[model samples]
Target chain A: MKLKSTAALIGSIIGASLLAATPAHAQNVKIGLLSGITGPIAAMAPPMIAASQLAVAHVNEQGGIGKGGKLEVVVGDSACNPQNATDAATKAVNIDRAVGIVGPACSGAVLAAANSVAVPAGALLITASGTSPQITSINDKDLVFRTVPSDDYQGRALARTLKGRDITKVAVAFLNNDYGKGLAEAFKAEFESLGGTIAGYSGHEGSKASYRSDLAELAKGGADTLVIFDYGDGTGLTILRQALENNFFKTFIGADGMKSDAVIRELGADNLGTFFTSSPVGEASSSLESFNKAFTAAGQSPDAIFTTTSYDAAFLMALAIEKAGGDNAKLAESLRAVSSAPGEPIMAGEWAKAKKLIAEGKDIDYKGAAGDHEFDKNGDVPGTYAFFKVSGGTYESLGEMK
Target chain B: MELIGLANYAIFMGILIGIYALLALGLNIQWGLTGLFNAGIAGFFAVGAYASAIITSPHVAGRVGGFELPIVVGWMGAIVFAGLIAWPIGKVCLRFRSDYLAIATIGVAEIIRLVIKSEDWLTGSSRGITGIPRPFGELDYVASQLAYLGLVIAAVAVVYFLLERQLKSPWGRMMRAIRDNEAAAAAMGKQIEARRLQAFIFGAAVMGLAGALFVHFNRSITPEAIDPMIATFLIWIMLILGGSGNNRGAILGAIVIWLLWSVSEMITDRLPTDVALQAKYIRIFVVGLALQLVLRFRPEGILPEEQARQTAR
Candidate 1:
């Protein structure tokens, strides 16, 4: 009894001290910048984080949220692991008091954060890169939104891209995750529906040392092309190398995750001749051009998958916060107002003008750098596709997927 | 206002520590008492998680188990399934030395990971099973978090009590004897292999229970829920640092290590973006260094194993 009482007393003191430690800072509206900074896709984090920071910096320079109140971003590393992502989301929302989150990056991490943290905490989360169709049905009450189109759109685009090349038969090897599974399933369905036969399909676990067996089996299906859905930094390289060693595959079709300089460097430009990749493209707009310029001017690459989308995610969340007058309860509703149509058009880097329009109590359509977003009730964006093929040691845009 | 948030964070941390404590206790039973190094705690944990998830989640197209049974039933299924899986593995590996068991257990874990990843119909095909009904999950945010904390605390207390009782029993003494001196204990008519197998399966069942607790708390389970090596090593360190034979030590080590890891992360998170980017590696280095320091100085652990008064010889 004595020990228990002592524990209770200590706990109360700790709680009281914790409560006292936080003095209110109403001038800064905290936003969470979350991404997988230390896992399979860690390579993708530096630029994405920079993009978010650039958005915040740009917002601050544009007279901030409202009446000189700044937007402060708290960075959280999701690590691309579900549990870690959940924990990171919780900390960013609860401890750091972030009113909104700009990312959780990967579909799996975003899913974990959305269901486990964002929804429960009532914090608005705008994922910059999550493209899994599974995210389309996460039950987040519109709190979870993404700048990228789901794989449902990417799959159709991939099907069309492959068919245009007269490649009708394909074997598929996908990393086991929401992004991989959703893209693979969507691609298979669209490809089959388009009269192309799926020669084989294998969903392999990621981070494995090798995928020789699965690749060999996929090879035996007699498909001329191997369509792989996986992040370039993880098992995708190993799988391709193993298949090459076994002479299992040469021709390749890949999704957005494979549109990386790392994949080209690792697989060699010589071997990429027969390779083609399709990813969601931002509609060509002056906003996109400016964002690309600003991003590169900050000494970061703007060409990586999702870099522009991440910048737009941060920019949109800040706009929402500003429009809501820093009230988190109204932030979600304000997000829809800012990103959807039926408003005065506002381009990226026009935060000062957007602030003026919001002050006039007029709805402003944020034509973001990534695209013109008109969020559905489920917070999904309309998708456009960019087809690219390896050329001159890098991926050169072939054409739009239409 | 910030105090409430901190309290909620504490509760979340407490809940995770409690679940990890269950795993640590399981490891204590296996390695601390029986001299068996079951390196596949993550595998057994996954079995429990996937089993419970399969049992309790709402039915989806192309997947098994729309039963949507009560959470208790799911937990029971988790324990039973994890125990049964461990039973076969233990039967095959308990006859060998600990190194062989380690290798076999890791293999089992890898295989289990593959099954969870590849078997889409069974485990929801990498999107994983979601919408798991969390008890008291419907309550308001603070209330819900508190209720879950209460549930986790209760589970840990029950596990701790039962295991403590089991530890002081005759079977516990016999198991310790076998662990300390296998030849002498074998000569004394204690069927060592069978007993080891029993402990192994029982420990794995506990780990499965931990998985159930975790899945229910998150209200979802994915193939990537647990980092196999990092989680397994953390639990191993907890058991080693807290003193293997002591139940209290196991729980203590869990809470301490988890707190340290998370607290360090929170501190590093406050750094500037550029500095914080490099802080994650520093956090890992600190954890690694702490473990080494603990091993070098207090190899027997914070609370060293209490030596039994009676000698088998």
Candidate 2:
């Protein structure tokens, strides 16, 4: 009797698992939405996912992908870690059978998932906002792509921003992670190449109770300005406060990671007068304006940095599927075909027009809501960075970097 | 193709379970037999990982690696270095109770994390040391994953064999005796501190070896690879669930916990985006609840330690 019961239990579990493994999507084109759902970048994920959903809704409303099949997005939480992201990506591929994966936002997670899951499964991966220079070096057979430009561009832009301000000497402290270290190195190289001196530079581990000693060390180098390359969460704020208390550097500069309203609110506009930051500059296009208006009207703010980019990635993925006639295998080739030049310029929010053009067998260059996206061989798009200054407790754009 | 994907997933999960089983085995030596509390398994793991990565990876211009030693030698170096790092802490803390050892280990793990993060030359700072040599990394996805799984399983088997033998040996009995009664063991003229230190170091060496296997399998190690607290806690629960003083239980527990973890992820991924986002925390809560159920109902664990018996085979 006991043996029969054990056998029954095992059989039931196998049956249930097999049932779960089989996806029930009979007439829907499935795309995977992978992102940092519950890690350090958790705050950024909700808006991005919401924006992607908006894109999906818009695509479905416009008669769905190829012959009336609704596009369904399978969401996977990456938590910005390699192992978890790999597992998530694999589940999306093997079970959900996603044709393309939209994100696994952290650089390390992207590298891991791209190599282990997406490339092997022959699925196209387009990360919405992972900006590590190391990601450009992954041998992923062109299966991996990112909508955002890598840190190599951002670092150069930041250095040029500093040099243009005539700041010749600076100290740099960055959070130790792919994003932080890569940006810091790029900035240092660019700054030094532009005839500026790096008085002192160091990488600091985040979530520490105090960085006073490290801050003191950087302060001792006596650089006129301090460049902080880190996320705007508590860590960056703490460091900034400590530096302020110590009266370390006269000027403080930060990159996209530190461009947060929380920083402005915490530090206050008066005290943040000497502070400046740079973020990926979104170009003014009709697509962007429409996306902003629609996004806001849906009771969601479009102010979040990657909201437009996430929408564009989803929009592009859907358009690629449509162009491929709902073939998952051909999605990769179609992704490049639609996003590159020598085609009809399909503006964002013009899904109906794109569908019409795709059906007519004409190539389409998708000018994204984020901006003009012409991908290089490495799947990176060149972009501009805008400088922002705290003005009356809000960021005011100074100008765009050349 | 679907079956192949499932096979790949199983192989990948199997490799992780093997690596985690090695960690559990190490903890069994420390907490199960020797009555030591180690709260810094991830620290030792990072040390072993970075040591192997530095030794085996090709030299880059700004980083410390480039020697590109043989993979086997790097693995051995990882074990030796991890043991060496554990020696001083064990020596200092073995004089006190297990709580002190736990506290010291936690501090050491944090310091190791800091070093890995801040020391850009030694570890590639945030763009961590990548391209670590894997034994069968060049193989096709399924074949490579299968080969790596085999390697990890072999490592786990070796560790298990050594640990089981040690547990049945005279030294193992003496260590347990000291753990159960320090005053009595000291009175019996057994050098309690030396034995405890030895067990701690050896167990830590096993964890380091696990780390080496882990990095090689992944082809890289980043500071974010393991959450020190959650990972450490998970192993603790695994050891306790599988029965601490039993070698077979450790491996079984590792597999069981990992399967539970991954299976829960599979279930959560099927939920809608909004609910799926919230479900990860729920899964963690479920794991906690399962632990409570195990502790309340079967405190000795699923595979309780087999008491040493006098009857001959």
Winner by lDDT: 1
Writing each residue's lDDT as its tens digit, candidate 2 over B53-148 gives: 899998888889898999998899899989999998787766767688788788888888878877778988667777677897777767877888
| Model 1's DockQ score | 0.52
Tell me the tens digit of each residue's lDDT in model 2 across A356-393.
99889988999888877787888888876789888988
Per-residue lDDT of candidate 1, residues A47-108 (tens digit)? 88898899899999989977767888888878877667877777888898888888898777
Candidate 1 regions with alpha-carbon error over 4 angstroms = A1-26, A205-216, A233-250, A265-271, B308-313
Candidate 2 regions with alpha-carbon error over 4 angstroms: A1-26, A208-217, A220-224, A241-249, A326-329, B1-4, B308-313
For all predictions, the C-alpha RMSD in Å is: 3.5, 4.1
Clashes of each: 0, 2
Q: Candidate 1 at A359: error in angstroms?
A: 1.5
For candidate 1, write residues B139-237 as lDDT tens digits. 877788889889989988998999888888998899899998999999999898899999999999999999999888878777777667555878998
Residue A266 accuracy (lDDT) in model 1: 89
